[model samples]
Target chain A: MVMHYPNGQPYRTKQLSLKKSPYPTATLYGNRGMTLEEEINESNQYYLKQGIAVIHKKPIPIQIVNVDYPKRSAAVIKEAYFKQPSTTDYNGVYKGHYLDFEAKETKNLTAFPLANFHAHQIEHMKACQKQGGICFTILRFTSLKEVFLMPASLLFQYWDNQQANNGRKSIPYEIIKKQCAHITYQLQPKIPYLTYVDKLLEQIL
Target chain B: MVMHYPNGQPYRTKQLSLKKSPYPTATLYGNRGMTLEEEINESNQYYLKQGIAVIHKKPIPIQIVNVDYPKRSAAVIKEAYFKQPSTTDYNGVYKGHYLDFEAKETKNLTAFPLANFHAHQIEHMKACQKQGGICFTILRFTSLKEVFLMPASLLFQYWDNQQANNGRKSIPYEIIKKQCAHITYQLQPKIPYLTYVDKLLEQIL
Candidate 1:
């Protein structure tokens, strides 16, 4: 059976349903259920307030073709078109190390889909890694209520193998659990992903 | 006399008109007249291709209230409202330095207006500077056709002064020219602002 989103979009689901009554939603509507994007954004805010790390989500670029000057102070965008982003979603500095990452959520229970990532994002991550920055992807299995922070090195390895006609389209959940750190959620911080980041840094050190 | 933009927006001209249209009027909208944001974005692309930097403009967060899912692939944002950004516009890593800055353009001729910047942006820049990261502003005087790279330290000095009833709303053009390096436009690289960044680094070194 296919699980349908509140917006009526069909999604892949596991045998165990994680669906629960959605109450106390965000100010944003379709965001009735907390999205991985919102959770991470909130987590970044938490990090910033504590002076731990400074990361921010890049804005989606839109070409404002036409604008209406309704008043001198307020310029309303009348006609605009979205542009494809050329970089990862989140980036900043943490403990003198430049950090860059993209966060994605998939409903698939067995593996994370390759299609969830774009060609440019992989290329951008490769470029960041070359520059000696810590680059990674935070993958979330929404159906399983699990999140994993996978390094870009492993991601690039899998991505290159896929190009070589390898059968792996998605990373298996078991492999992720073994290779990546799982993050827990908190109240004010929401997604306490950075706690895992500290652990990852300790391992690297 | 007030100078009007090609799009009919009134601007305060800093100097007398030097030359009339030598080229045909049709060339005005061609490759020569890209917006400051577009130029910077293109320059970032150039930096990425060269494996030099990985800067990206932060997306303006929007509170998406409603969306129309006509197809499974296409989710159209129907009802949404803009949210205030919490950090600087542009951020990334360049030569092991964490770079963060905001690009702003104004029509004011006498000085760069302080009101163009927000409170959170100032606070964010201060935080980045405290961490020994490179933080600055790329200020473009559209009416004067001039751009300058002002360091966050100098910016914060003026920003703080404004709070103490300094009575200065804009930074004088002479001070900017004396203290900050000017950026020239180029074809493929667009803004070529990072050349000024090299000079800034030289001063620090």
Candidate 2:
């Protein structure tokens, strides 16, 4: 049966579910409209092709409970469940520096919520940061058509504050605009995120 | 239905298939009959606990299809297929340096076969190497009870030579014994692989 929104527009469950997909799908046209992960993946591919960087979105972890093997055919997974990943969704090497990050999207114009990140993911990023890997988050305000690369250190401050008794649940949009590295979209590479990563590298070195 | 091997021992299809499973399974014993991936995972856990290094096995890439979303219950994947990975199996950061590697085990005592590696994996490693990321392969001779970390540069040489006509199909056991850094199994970490990675770091530095 087809579903509809309360406003009378048709609801697309498949597209909604696929938008949460962990892997990138192919796009035939220029960036007409894509999710944050898709944009980063395309930019990563461009960087890889140009020999500027080597990065990839890690595959979603699935726990397989049962599989079927038939004669003269490939094995088919009959039962499985999505397993939670211990690390962030994206990681790779760039110019001899280890880069790690998580991408997030939100429609709210006032702020980006901290609940979008998991506690374990925060711990993982903290561990990577201790190892000197450049860690950050790619934040996209889709309604505002803006993106920012916020360093992990700044994020930890907010996270720790929220864990305390009285802390704000979200980061103000004005704060992100002032503190983070804003990435302008481009034609060839789409996101041009590494330009900001290079900036982070300069600060570190 | 039960089957038997040539030596009259009952065949364990599940264990045989599980041996080829990509993700590591838990073990209660102290390095008692674990696969190469399991040992590496255990050692990675130890390293993570000790703040020595941060490494993880990339989850197996799965192409999920036809999920059933029952009300008030977790979604169950009804059908899916395994997708070939474009890069190596294991990668992470160790002391500010990027590490990438593929782990393989063989029963042949003479050599490790080149067929075990995919063409795109070699290309991925080359891309990583050009970016100055540390790349290598973890090879375990199951029958010989030996493990070695062979540099990706060496593996690439063999790979390219084999691509040309009249090249040997495997790296000779003697060459690997002489060229690669051998890892000793330990009780605490199970397989102390990163000690050799530190050695490789010494050479690179």
Candidate 3:
């Protein structure tokens, strides 16, 4: 059954559920359409085609509430909601190293709010790190058109401080600029973050 | 709206859609209740808690059709269908090495059919292998209650030969037993395949 709104828009339209991402709303980061995640996705495909790396964004987990099975056609999920993932958005292998990271964009001028990440994500990164995976966060300051890769170890210090009620709720951009590598956007593999990965490989190896 | 059967069973029940997996029907392999996938999930959870590995089965991606908003509680996914994934079911880091594999079961006593896998999954495994990740498939023979971890390299050889129309469509049990490590079942981890992983690591490192 089709549901029509007072404005004549159908409730069953595709646009409704596509907007639901688990991240806290950052209305200040006004994306005209494409998100940082989209760019990384495109970049990952490029990397794949060039045989540079094999990273991928895992699909968002959903809790399905209802589905309808028709005789001939595919099954239809009629009711579902997104679930919080236990790990980060992207992970893969780079030069025999296990790579994992999360990407988030903000319009904040002075700081990248640590609130953008969840506790479970922190735990997951720590777990991966313990297993020898390189884990980090990719922070995009949209308004500034700047991206930075901050190691999970550094992020944890601040997160731990926040939990102890002894520090700022976010990491100031100045520290990020000082400590993290600035990721410049490229045309083919737009997020060429692996250039930073090359440097990371150098440090570890 | 509520739906009811002639016997008065409610349509909003969870039993309907939970049965859907993209694999071709293998009704001949009767499952008492818990499946091989569920067992691996349990084992993965056990590994995670013990800090032994950081592996996880990727969520089944769904192409949603319709959703309903009830004004209270979570959003309801009204219609959705399972989508084919390009990669294997599970991937993660194990002691600094990237791990990727798929789990499959068949009742066939003589052989494990290659038809159980898709071309895209093969492509994905090859791509991951190129990036220095370890790739393999976990095969279970239901009637024999036996499981084996066959490296993707071996699987690829058979797949390539089959595509060239020069090999058996399925891998014979003798070959699997001779070539792959047997996965022993245990109580705590249930499918303690990581024991096979430990052996593989010994061979490599």
Q: What is the TM-score of chain A alone in each candidate?
A: 0.80, 0.84, 0.84
Local accuracy of candidate 2 as per-residue lDDT tens digits, B1-205: 4454322222344455445433322111112223687778888999999988889988767666556655555557777766677888889999999999988887789999887788899999999999989999989888899999999988999999999865999999999999999888899898888889999989877
Two-chain DockQ for model 3: 0.43
Name the 10 consecutive residues with the lowest summed lDDT in model 3 chain A. A25-34
What C-alpha lDDT, on a 0 to 100 scale, does residue B140 get in candidate 3? 92
For model 2, name the residue pairs that clash: none
- Docking model 1 quality class: incorrect
Q: Deviation in angstroms for A163 in model 2?
A: 1.1
Every candidate's DockQ is 0.22, 0.37, 0.43
Listed for each candidate, the true contacts retained, as a fraction, are 0.20, 0.57, 0.58
Q: Could you tell me the TM-score of candidate 1?
A: 0.76
**lDDT ranking of the models:** 2, 3, 1
* lDDT for each candidate structure: 0.69, 0.79, 0.77
lDDT tens digits, residue span B60-158, model 3: 666655555554455456656667776788999988999999888887899998878889889999999888898888889989999898888789999
Runs in model 3 with CA error above 4 Å? A1-34, B1-34, B68-70
Residues A56-76 of candidate 2: C-alpha lDDT, one tens digit per residue: 989766777776655445657
Which residue runs of candidate 1 sit more than 4 Å off their true CA positions?
A: A1-34, A61-84, A202-205, B1-34, B63-66, B71-73, B79-82, B186-188
Tens-digit lDDT track of model 3 for A1-205: 6564332223443464346645444311222213687788889899988998889888657765545556556656665665667888899988888999998887789998887887888999999999999998888887898989888877998999999976889999999999889998888888889999888767766
Candidate 1 residue-wise lDDT at B103: 83
lDDT, residue B24, model 1:
35
Order of all candidates by TM-score, from best down to worst? 2, 3, 1
Q: Which candidate gets the maximum TM-score versus the true structure? A: 2
